[model samples]
Target chain A: MIDLSQTISSNTIVYTLDMVGVAACTIAATILAKRLQFDVLGAFFVSFLGSVGGGTLRDLLLNRHPIFWLHDLNYIHFIIGLSLIVQIFYHYVERLDKALRWFDALGLAAFTVIGVESALSRNMSAPIVMLMGVFTAIIGGVFRDIVCRQIPLVLQKEIYITASLVGSVYYLLLLQTGINEWLRSISTLLLIFSVRMLAVYRGWNLPDITLQPKEKQK
Target chain B: MIDLSQTISSNTIVYTLDMVGVAACTIAATILAKRLQFDVLGAFFVSFLGSVGGGTLRDLLLNRHPIFWLHDLNYIHFIIGLSLIVQIFYHYVERLDKALRWFDALGLAAFTVIGVESALSRNMSAPIVMLMGVFTAIIGGVFRDIVCRQIPLVLQKEIYITASLVGSVYYLLLLQTGINEWLRSISTLLLIFSVRMLAVYRGWNLPDITLQPKEKQK
Candidate 1:
């Protein structure tokens, strides 16, 4: 089998993966909207937020101009088209929770790497770059959940952010070892995707920390 | 009484008003945190989000660099110091809900004007500028409420966003009349403050639109 990563430039691979990630996020959000019984407009809005909100925030934080969606109308067009299609097929699409998790995992992996690359291009330090990676991977979901009036999933006792953070640190370390660019990208993406999927499959969760007050004497 | 607006440059007036707005928003958020019984760190986070979140979102949308808080460390320092003080004085401050509404109104007015001016500087169109103004006035509270896991107040039946939108349109019209800079600023400020306070005092609300399904035959 031909290795696509070996044949394609790293930028092209990343860009393609980013598009897939955006599409996956939009689909997942559309399913959520259906479950929430949001109207067509609400579904469109949530899907847009889920697909682009994180990168938009990241670009703003890094002072990147002409935000990604505005700079290329194709992303907007794609989201609008996909949201409409998903809404039209909501009866069938709403039952895809099993598939939705996989799409979300793929999005998490792709967005983490994309965020890291974006920050790296801006010459950010390692810690900030890793933070950006995690931010990019999870913030759109946070925005989606916030708009839905629920606590963000990442902020809950989920192993989601941990997977993204570990993958980011792993990618950073890989950069130092002078690995093949495509290999590094693919390997990091696989690592995040596997970790997230495994967490979901095993029902892994971060321990919830609650501070208890000292017991008063009766 | 001396007209301080007349003595100070319009830029300085806006700058000073911006600071007042920030402090007011921070204090309002701190009061909210006290009611919620959040820890000090949570209080600080909420206050920071309340004070700067709107403008930061606006600047990012307009593609302005370094973000307003990052460009001036004073905003950060001020937020931290004010949040800490408010946390310490929670016993007294929490009882100031009557006073809190006034501060919230003042912030809405100031931030609306600041957002308008920032957009005008960017040479945006009238409608977009007005939107920027409304966005800047209310997004912080939206952020704060979303974090607290509630529907944003502006999105509710409250007359809050209406006040910001009307003030923005009024300010835009004033710009056409070529009025004295201070007079324009002061008058517009008063208009928004009055509109908001009046709405609060009268317990006015926007009509909530609910689409009713056609009655089915029994």
Candidate 2:
């Protein structure tokens, strides 16, 4: 049986490591997205967004002080490490983009769950929790997209944010049933990933509500 | 003498118009920066950051409610206007790049003074207000540079942040002396613009903290 205190300690360790993973994954995603034209500095910005943007937004919303970063400089080291990794592994990502797609989905799923759970622990309202979940899922990518000068995926005509919303709500509902923590974590991750993957595969999109152009032009 | 309330109102109008000017300047900035082959979506992203990123970050730190755009949809309209202006009047900016450079400096000066006023109005400490002033002045350009795949102006050994810091401190010093708002604003703006322009012309940069390799790589 895993002791609860040990579980908490282990989770913290894993989270910090996973943050580094986010940085690395962000670099891979941007490199692939931009087709190798993104330079070292661009890769660094993407990695920073991938690793830190989501958590930073979460902390800001929760009114947490010092941020996860302003206190410990480990994240800075992680970003540097990830940037070097990209410099070394550029060819590998270019040659194998498909596998990285799946990797990106898994990363997104894991991050969504973590964000939603963090909000719930702070006793946020359900809507706020869901918003937090969506914010967490997209902010890193959104920041990356902004820095990359691309339309944010959330604003794109796709089911991206919707999939995140569905998964967040499902996870919260399951929690009400007294599910085991580990199982809940795994299952929610699976749910978010599958839903998102399916949505992407299907080209699902929300209804467009574009404002019609006013007359008076030629 | 100007009525105090009318003066405040006029400043607010100027503040709002400056926001629009910032937006227009951003879109124009990106179109020029990416005159080479580029992703158009990324261009809009750069415009968005250059227009709103600084103020948004300021609000986030200040713990204000309903971020500026969320409160009034005018910012959204401003963005649309920028996009349209770029699509139509881009050639003009290209023709005037040399002259427009000074306009960019003016925008920076105006933004730094306005940023200091905003922070001080929120009752932030002088140091924190100065920091906010510097942040607002540089973040937009820093963001634009990163997305354009270049080192940020401040990070590139430029005098960008230095100008903002000087201007902000000067603004505070003026306030301490009971200087009238209009004169104080003009002096601060001139100080920031002159310092920044002089540094750019002179190629001034703080020394880079270089570290020699302890061991040579083969």
Candidate 3:
């Protein structure tokens, strides 16, 4: 006899949200592949890597078996389907570069919250958890950009990583206040998304940390 | 009282080999960072990634906790020390590019065997094990190259990926034959190293598989 009244757990919800982030990031990778004029296989490879890279690292660090994607085919299907759709509609995607940034920001936020919660669940220290959150939020895109031979936006003169760091730390602080779990997660997501979007809008960026003299600057 | 005579297993040997590989790859990464003219911090970051990226991914996929490096500070110390040495001897390294390739090949071989054995211990399928081995063999360099904004040599015209796949598959076949374990492992290491070196000497490479027409190819 199956228990019919069991509520879905927060872990499950976070997993679902992470998948959504993966899907969005996969789409972004596909678009980047198109821009790079990669072949179909290269495009698919980059998309898959972008979708799963961060979460895979998280699961590995946490010692989760089979990895998230390996346990189910849905993530793979989503990535492939989304990649194909993007390939067919790349012209439209070019016009929606702004929307792409928003989608990526949404993924970043969702991933950050999910990463934070997962690390917290594992009883990792707060700073480590927060950094894991930031790593999760940014590494997938970093992988994609690197594979495509572009400087990762996270390492560029941008506020992307800073936004993730702040959001994750904020979420951890909220957790200590005994707030409603769902509310706290939602707030974290919003905080990251909003900060990233504002950074994009306001052209916010960290000063260059290059060690070379002015003539050697790129 | 702790038992004094329980001999260190093959696992320990492979792990030590993997660490040696890590050190070699770290030096390679530091050299690459220098050629890229990264700052000191950037050089260290790249070196650390090259040292641990492959093993980290393998551990993650196999659900190993705390990761190998996290469990021991020695890996961290080795990376830092190697990075400093390479930084101080950057000019000497420039004159020894040939030696760098040899060290890299040795790392590739050792990492491949370790990765293969780890996956096999987890009862992964043969194909998956081989692929994981290849991933472990090449991914660190792939990462270092990608982060430095160079095309990953694995995906470039190099014969790198082929050698890994061959070495791993060969090692697995040897295991199935119930051969002496140390002999099997050492042979696999030698095979990969030899293949890679020969490919370099012979100027062997896979043909480009660009999907674009001649005029559009890069």
**Lowest lDDT 10-mer window, candidate 3 chain B?**
B208-217
Model 3 misplaced regions, further than 4 Å? A1-47, A54-64, A71-142, A151-218, B1-9, B36-42, B208-218
What DockQ do the predictions score, one after another? 0.12, 0.06, 0.15
Question: Residue-wise lDDT of candidate 1 within B174-214, one digit each (tens)?
Answer: 99997987777777788999999999999887542223233
Model 2: runs farther than 4 Å from truth? A1-139, A142-218, B1-4, B13-17, B200-218
Considering chain A alone, what is the TM-score of candidate 2? 0.81
Lowest lDDT sum, 10 consecutive residues, model 2 chain A, at A209-218
**In candidate 1, what are the lDDT values of residues A139-189, reduced to their tens digit?**
998888877776787877678889999998999999999799888889999
iRMSD for each candidate structure, in the order shown? 6.3, 8.8, 5.5
- Give per-candidate clash totals: 0, 2, 1
* DockQ value for model 2: 0.06
Evaluated at residue B91, the lDDT of candidate 1 is: 91
| Candidate 1 stretches greater than 4 Å from native | A1-55, A58-64, A68-141, A151-218, B1-8, B39-42, B216-218
TM-scores for all predictions: 0.59, 0.54, 0.59
In candidate 2, which residue pairs get closer than 3 Å at backbone N, Cα or C atoms, i.e. clash? A149-B42, A150-B42
Write out fnat for all predictions, comma-separated.
0.18, 0.04, 0.25
Candidate maximizing TM-score: 3
